[model samples]
Structures are given as structure tokens and as C-alpha cells.
Target: MARYVTGAPPPSLDPAVVALLEKAETATIGHWRHWGFVDRRVAPLLPRRRVAGTAFTVMLPANDGTMLAHALDHLRPGDVLVVDRLGDRRHACIGGGLAVAAQAAGAVAAVVDGPCTDLEEIEEAGFPVWCRGLAPVTTQIFDMGGAMNVPVSIGGAVVMPGDAVICDNSGVLVLPPGEAEAEARRAIETQARGAETARRVAAGELRMGVVSGATARVTGG
Candidate 1:
């Protein structure tokens, strides 16, 4: 027997907090020592787009997509749908129609641990999606049971509803709501420092080896 768990609605993060994270790169967020990055194989359908929002998680069975309908209804503006396909990489559980539905529901993006279909339609809809890849084969409406708004594992990272989700060209990462603001601050500082270092290097005021202290360390000078 399958189960459906509609947990409490996740709390939305402050808009300011979301904005801070949206400006930071996914790579910087991944350095927070948390297990939040989805697999590299799961990549964006459209290039150079970034999405940051609260997570609305979904868990699906191997060949069933019945619960996706329910998950769609739970979406809120600025929510990112994080779907866990339970290690079934064979069948695509989302496609063009589903992507459109999600967008209509105000979902900022969709990140799936499994494959997706109808690449052309998805791209045409302008809905950002990160998934294992494209597959002509799709899941059937088996009415098999699944869960919504529950913790799910995607690409070895456990995602909970309301967790901060950031997706970009680098990959997808989920941050605990409590840690998002602090981590965003750290990433911002890091980005600023990197930019200044690059500027100095470009002007010949500093060298890569001097900036990184690698030359002296390696040569024991």
C-alpha cells in the first residue's frame, strides 16, 4: 500500500533573504558544509538562468506520477518544486504539460532527480527545469501512491519543504531556512573579495601565486 503525507505548509522566507541568496552563486552556497547540491547530471534546461525560492518537495514512486498533480496544487509564488523520483532514473516523471502547470501555479523552478520529457515544449514555455536529462519515455498515471510536502532525497541531498532552494548553471542546492540568511551573507562577502582580487591581478598589482600564497608555500621560500 502507498501513502500520501500532506504535511504542514512550509513557511515562506522573507523576500529580502531570498533576494540575498538569489544574487549569490550556487557554488558559493554549496561550500556551507551542508548536503544540498543535486547531482551534476541534473542540469538546467535553459542556459544561464538562476532560481532561488522556498522548496515544495514531492516524492514519487518508480513509474507513477499520480502525486505530481497534488504537488502542483501546493505550489506558492516563489516556491521551487523539488521532486525526488526514488532512484528511478529510467522514466521521466515530468514533461512539457507538467512544466506549464507548475509555472501556472507560480513555481519559480522545478528540480527533479529523475529524467524529464518534451524538451522543446519545456524550453518554449520558459519554465526553468533542472533534471537528470531528457527522455522520450515518460511515467504513466498509475494512481500509485506518493507523498507531498515531505522530506525527500535528491542526488544524495535531503530536501525538506521550506528549505531555501537555489538553482543555476552550476547545479541545484538546498539550504535550511535557518541557515540561509547567514550563508548568503558569507557568500556575498566571498564574491566581493574575489572580485577585488581579480581586479588587482588584472592591473598587475597582484599575481595569482601571491594572492593564493601558493608560490612561497610550494617553493618553501
Candidate 2:
């Protein structure tokens, strides 16, 4: 087989769509959808930061980072590099250099199915990465066959190049472009409603159980 298998970069999501999705928290979305969430094992390096963007995906070989460079080369603004490590959680293919490179290419963030290294450099670069964890061992440009801009799995979530990637402290969520807009809109409305409920409780106009419906359910009133 060829040393590398790749495809053209998928179309990017509209910036307006991205803006809408960014404000919609994954936890809020979780209340409605049963799927499309990345495994909890994969988490954010900076939990406080939230980002939304188009998925620019790559299937990286277990210990080879050759395809990563290609993926970076093609990354456009507002893209998130979603890496499938082929189940190699031991070796980290992403580190300081790749983080900086991808950020310079206008990537909003990256999601990896495995570990990553160079924590100091990555933090210094101020890039957000959702990954398994930190590792001392790293991958190399071994030229093993890999693919870019194609469908891949991250944390058991199937991600495509054009998918909508929303990530934050909670976890990473991938959604089809068409579905993303509606989901984000719903989540936003739900968040507003939730906030209003919290406000009433804080104002002493309602109790916690009353807000949650537990009071009625328990009292049968």
C-alpha cells in the first residue's frame, strides 16, 4: 500500500454557524442527544476554554506523524484537526511543534484519540487540544501509510472532515453540519431557560425542588 492515503480538505463550516455553535455548551447539548459525544477519556488540556469549528480530520498511523504535516498544510482558518491515532495511546504524535504549526495555519483546536507531549510548549503556544493525556514518548515521521481529510474515529465518536466539532471542559462533541445548527439553536434556548430558572431560585421566588419538579413529584401535588 502507499505510504500515505489522503483526500481533499472538506468544505469549512460557515463562520456564522461556528459562532452559534461556540456559544452552545456540549453539556447542554448532551441533555438532548444520546450520541456524537467523544469518549470521556479524551479531554481538554485547558478545560476552561471552549471552541467550535469545522473538523479537518486525519487518520494518523500508530507511530508515524507524516500525515500530520500534510493535514496541517491543508488546514484553513476555523478548522479543528481531529486525529485518529489508530488506537495507539502510548505514543503521542502531537506536541509543541505540531500545535504551533496548526495554530499558525488558523486551526481553532485539535482533538486526538490518544496522548500528546510537550505540555510546556503547547501551553506557551496557547492552543487548545482535546486529547487522552500527556505522554513522554512521541511519534515520528516514520512514513507509515496514513490518511487525511477522511472519516476517522476519535474516542469512539465517528468524525468526518466536514463535521462540526464542539469542545470544552465537558468533552468533545461531533455533529453532522446539517444537524449542528439546529442542535446549537436548541441548546442556546435551553441555556436561556435554565438561566431564568436559576435566577428565580436565587431570588427566593422558588425552591430548588420546585424548580426541578422534584417537589411536585414527591408531594404528588
Candidate 3:
């Protein structure tokens, strides 16, 4: 059996906010739809937590909740465990107990493209988890799943060990290898500008001036 390891630490940032904006909003996801790296269906089950670093993905034959339990034994701090339950909604791949273990093992967060159990427990532990929904049903480990970093699909995105995954209240976003640093800079700036515009609107600024001017520049009008 081979073990997975990150060659180096990821770019430094506040984990909470990093996870918050890492998601490609519906619009951005549409923009990257052709890139084949977006997961459009997963929803956040708990509050946002920063997620960065190489993706450490595990593919389970089904929703065997114990995969995270086993994987935590080797998961290092700052790792993002991406779990695939073969797109099964019959059971949850993660729940409260596993959330605590993953956090204790130093994982940044967990993203399950299937269901999850122990919603209250996960929230109590303060470990961020994003999943499709909640379900108490679970699959036995005997079915299938692997650890120590691997590539797997979530929604429609193919995530590899060590690739960047950004999740927020908006949605989940994957940053391809060698793209995190630059993309993060651009994302942060775009988000900040958006926030500023929102504030101005709250103070009664008209979109005709700010938004229209930007639209015209892009349209070359």
C-alpha cells in the first residue's frame, strides 16, 4: 500500500475565509463548465471553514461512513479529505464522529458529495463539513473506499490528491494544480470589489453608474 504526502505546505491564508470564497459561484462555475473541474451539486452542511492545500481524495464503493475514520489515521493537519460515495444518496459518507476525528488529525475540512449523518454533532465539534444532505443510514467499510490520497470525482469534478478545493456558503470550487496562488489573488480581489459594491448599494448607490460603466468597458461600448 502506498502512502500519500504533500510535497510542501499550501499558500498561507486564513483558513476560514479561504474556504468561504474558494467556491465557484453558480456563475463562475458556468464559466468553467468547459474545464471539467467543477462540482455543481454539493451543498454545505455546516458553516464555512477555510480549505486549501493539495486534495486528498478517497473513493468509496459506497457510503461507508468509516472511510474517514480509517483515513484519519494517516491524514495530516491541513489536508482536505474529499470523499466519494459513488454518488450514492442512500447513505452518508461522513457524520459527527468522523468530523471530530478528521479535525483532531489536523484536517482543514471535509467535503462529501453524498449524504452525511450527525448534523448536530458535526456542528458541535466545529469542524466544517460540506455535503449533499443529512442521512442516518450508512454503508459498511467492506463495500469500498481508499485513503492516503487519491483522485476521485465529486459532483462532476475530478479531484486529485493535493489539488486545491475552496468551499463557501456559495458553492464548492476546485483550483487545479499550479493554479491556486494566482487564482486566490484574483478571487480575493473580485470578492472585495463585490462587497464594496454591495455596501454602496445598501447606502443607495445606483447600479447604472458603477455596474453599467464596468459592463460598458467589457462590451467595448
Off by over 4 Å in 2: none
The residue-by-residue lDDT of candidate 1 on 168-205, one tens digit each, is: 89998888999989888899999899899999999999
Candidate 2 is scored at a TM of 0.96
Lowest lDDT 10-residue stretch of candidate 2: 1-10
Mark the 10 consecutive residues where model 3 has the least summed lDDT: 1-10
Q: Estimate each model's TM-score.
A: 0.95, 0.96, 0.75
Candidate 3 residues lying further than 4 Å off, grouped into runs, are 1-38, 63-67, 143-148, 199-206, 213-221
What Cα-based lDDT does every candidate model obtain?
0.89, 0.91, 0.66
- Total clashes, candidate 1? 0
Q: Where is the poorest 10-residue window by lDDT in model 1?
A: 28-37
Which candidate number would show the highest TM-score if scored against the true structure?
2
lDDT winner among the candidates?
Answer: 2
Off by over 4 Å in 1: 31-34
Native-to-model Cα distance after best TM-score fit, residue 164 in candidate 3, in Å = 0.7
Backbone clash count for every predicted candidate, in the order shown: 0, 0, 8
